[model samples]
Target: MSYPAAPRRSAVANAIYGLLNPIPFGFFVAAMIFDIIYAKTGTILWVKAAAWLITLGLLLAIIPRLVNLAQVWITSRRFSTGADHVDFWLNFVAIVAAILNAFVHSRDAYAMMPAGMWLSVLTVLLIAIGHVIIAVRYSTDRGYNHV
Candidate 1:
């Protein structure tokens, strides 16, 4: 007896995903951390750094998102796993949060205040959830079982 093979991304898609997906994650995480530091230190530098990091993350995120969108939704619907779908939505919301945070950061450092910090926190939280969904997609060797 054989288990049905789990729907999987193509090697090229996987490579593209592996390469680009983590970039935004790192950026968002760094931004969040910087936001926290800025909150504590009240330093303009940290806030400026956070803004740049968030902007860069959003820009890099576009490539993989477009590619994944083409593969997962446009090309064909071969994916059976729902995790990617959940992740997509989570990341979408996260990106929006990051965008808003970016605009907030554009204001005077002191003015950005709690709202920018909160937005950064929220963005990182959402992206982390999305990452968890991808991480949990294949915890077992057998992707799925049939009875």
Candidate 2:
């Protein structure tokens, strides 16, 4: 049996992915920090705004990342190995966590939920780790540099 060749991504696309991929995580961390402050001091505006902004950013980033993942998957035609696998799942979890943080946990400012705050923080950590793994892999992987 034969499989389709992997879709080749342009260097610009790879660079764009590398650059913009972590932005939502930064926003997520900021939002979580704001949420924690709100919990302590009873301020709501910044937390709400941060949460919404991170949500929007996550939604935007997920699309291109998904496309990238599809390209990777088509190239490999099997379960991802090494950093690629880890990056994929970490990103997937982060996206889900971001959604939960924005829609479920972020709905109210009057009551601060520990679960939401922690989830957002966890999402940030996951994204950071995933990015690090990918960056390290990219530095060593010849094919990654070619793109």
Candidate 3:
């Protein structure tokens, strides 16, 4: 007899993933701020470097997931036995967000000019919201006891 498939994530899991999505977003925002600060005051080269380093760390953390997704694409195989399409989509979105962050940070820093702080704030807000949603979803999926 064939065994039944595993159950999909509960509501709690979804909530967890959603909440966690903002973490990277925050990093990106901070990186942008760092770039802006450095541009304005080039004397603190170390500070500027530190800011970029943090941003790189955040991107690196997500690279594994990105690579895994790519591998799945190349292999033409199901990434998961469960309904993990959400996971894939969110992961891809995170990668996109990171890239955008990198671009903005690099541009602002290299130009040695102030970036649109208002736009940066808006972007951070959006990313934070995405993070919360993803955190909720993923946590619930992982069977995290939300109770």
Candidate 4:
């Protein structure tokens, strides 16, 4: 028996993925660090920065999420890895946590404490796992899977 050759992403898709994927992660990681700083220093600047970073991360995540949706949901049979669904859910949950973190950060500095920081930790953890899934699961011969 023979298997199909791997589905190759268009250069545009690859370009978009490569370009956009790291940005939100960077923002979120930065936000996480800021949250930690806030926890350590009890400084309002750190919390406010964390809020901005979370908001920016959410905004920046939209495009890459769309790309992943196109692959994991719309074209699963054609191109998505089995683990893509896991990746999608992980990112989706992380985005949700970031949204909650943003809302929490809207409160007074100390009010947002702990909760916002925890949410940031959750978001970062989910995204990190999602990134690992993409790295481990995607391959030419590994192919695709259905939902």
Candidate 5:
């Protein structure tokens, strides 16, 4: 079955995505900072953990939509750019980072919920599977190759 071409990466979208790209990264940083701060102060660990979980959840939810838009951009005939593997890799990396942050944040001295720890591990595994999907699909495309 054929799919519609990906829309061009508009200046607006580019700017937006570019700005948003730091989110996962920032979450990682924030998770670390919060952990260090709270671990030292010995207060509000649960609150920090909650914030980290919220960030992780938001990143997981929004990344798919961004990736879909990127896929459309890559598949579009007008762009003539067939390789979306790089975009997929970036998504994989971002999700992996977020998951790592979640895992790290869940190890707090205050209270580490087993459910959150397991969920982060599952998210990491799922993102790895997504990497496999990108690799398999791109390998079959013949028009794309690993860089």
Candidate 6:
């Protein structure tokens, strides 16, 4: 007996997904740097603005990603496994951390500093690891070039 062929996404859809894949990570990194600067410099308006702007960008990027993942699941009848799944979870964790960080920052409370800073750090580290995993997978897998 033969197994059914896997559902295929359109080339345009795949290309869009590829183009958007790294964007949130980029924004996360920028936001993390700005947050660190704000922490050190103590409430510099521009730094805070930059961090918030980048965080918003990150959130915007996440919407397309979630849609893409949903499309994949709808078409293929299964969620991705291995590296793709790991990347998804990592992004989820980063998004949650960003939201928490934003909440703490908005409160403008001194007592929240430790929690907010820790969440920011966690977000950065998770995004960095996720990026590294994607890079390694891209380098090692020739098949991804076709996608």
Best by lDDT: 4
Estimate, for each residue in 4-114, the C-alpha lDDT of model 4 and write its tens digit: 777776678668977998899999999999989999999889889888999999999999899878877875446776678898899999999999999999999999888
Candidate 2 pairs with clashing backbones: none
TM-score (all chains, Cα) for each model = 0.89, 0.75, 0.41, 0.88, 0.42, 0.73
Question: Where's the lowest-lDDT run of ten residues in candidate 6?
Answer: 72-81
**Once model 6 is optimally superposed onto the true structure by TM-score, how far is the C-alpha of residue 71 displaced, in angstroms?**
5.2
In candidate 5, stretches whose alpha carbon ends up further than 4 angstroms from where it belongs are 1-8, 46-73, 76-87, 96-147
Tens-digit lDDT string for candidate 6 (1-147): 455655465677677777876676666677667666767877756356645755675667666666566754565436354776677677777778777777776755444556666777888898778778877876765444544
Please say which candidate is ahead in TM-score: 1 or 2. Answer: 1
Indicate whether candidate 2 or candidate 3 has the larger TM-score: 2
Expressed as tens digits, the lDDT of each residue in 25-99 for candidate 1 is 899889889989999999889999999999999999998888777766766456635886788788889889989
Better of 2 and 5 by TM-score: 2
**Top of the candidates by TM-score:** 1
Ranking by lDDT: 4, 1, 2, 6, 5, 3
- Write down the worst ten-residue block by lDDT for model 2: 138-147
- lDDT by residue (tens digit), candidate 2, 71-104: 4676553635578878888888888878777775
CA lDDT of 120 in candidate 1? Answer: 88
List RMSD in Å for every model shown.
Answer: 3.1, 6.0, 7.9, 4.8, 8.5, 4.9
Clash-forming residue pairs, model 5 = 5-76, 6-72, 6-73, 6-76
How does residue 95 of candidate 4 score in lDDT?
94
- Model 5 Cα displacement at 108 (Å)? 7.7
Relative to the true structure, candidate 6 has a C-alpha RMSD (angstroms) of 4.9
Clashes of each: 0, 0, 30, 0, 4, 0
Q: Please list the C-alpha lDDT of all candidates, in the order they appear.
A: 0.86, 0.72, 0.51, 0.87, 0.53, 0.67
